[model samples]
Target: MASLTVQFTLRRYVARAYWTAVVMVSVFGTMAADVLHIGLGVPFAVSTPAFLSVPAAVFMLWYPSERTLSIHSIQTRRREAFRWAAALATFALGTAAGDLTATVG
Candidate 1:
């Protein structure tokens, strides 16, 4: 198990951020392909995770502390900011992955 105090550290945070971005990108790519092939809209596809992740991260960050997400100090504000930033970053990464996958095909 990991320590709570170190959960929001730069290293841990970066690792999580990188993974989330990868996930988003893969999901987006798959969802796009499905849409093109089936012509049916799917709910909670790549975008679904991206959308949920943002709020989920915020909740996690704020809930852990006191409505603030701070990366540097692990305070409420810093945690909140970190959460939001991570979520956005994941979305961007997902977009890139999806785009790359689509472009290649």
Candidate 2:
């Protein structure tokens, strides 16, 4: 049916958007972490924990607002927004941690 076809297309579009967001956020997060150290002269020891707190705060807000952190519960627009925020925060945290480790070694 036409409705089914439309639904399938919409789902595909959403999936593509999600993936694109992930890639873009990852790149930006890495760049941000690098900038904090290279541009501002902030050491990794300071930046790492600063970056990590972002995700922790995001989850603290998201869980209270949505009542769940499970990926399977990301069905509504609000939930999707929370998911994206959390994803971005996590990417930023991971990038900072990786950079910190590389610098320490």
What are the lDDT scores of the predictions, listed in order?
0.50, 0.75
Model 2: lDDT equals 0.75
Once fitted onto the true fold, the runs of candidate 1 whose alpha carbons sit more than 4 angstroms away are 1-75
How displaced is residue 88 in candidate 2, in Å? 1.1
The candidate maximizing lDDT is 2
Residue lDDT tens for model 2, 1-105: 232234334533466555656677677778888888899998888988998899888889989998899999777767766776777678777888988898798
* Clash list (residue pairs), candidate 2: none
Best by TM-score: 2
Clashes of each: 11, 0
Model 2: what TM-score? 0.81
Error of 2 at 33 (Å): 1.0
In angstroms, give how far residue 93 of model 2 lies from its true place: 1.1
User: Can you tell me which runs of candidate 2 are displaced by over 4 Å?
Assistant: 1-13
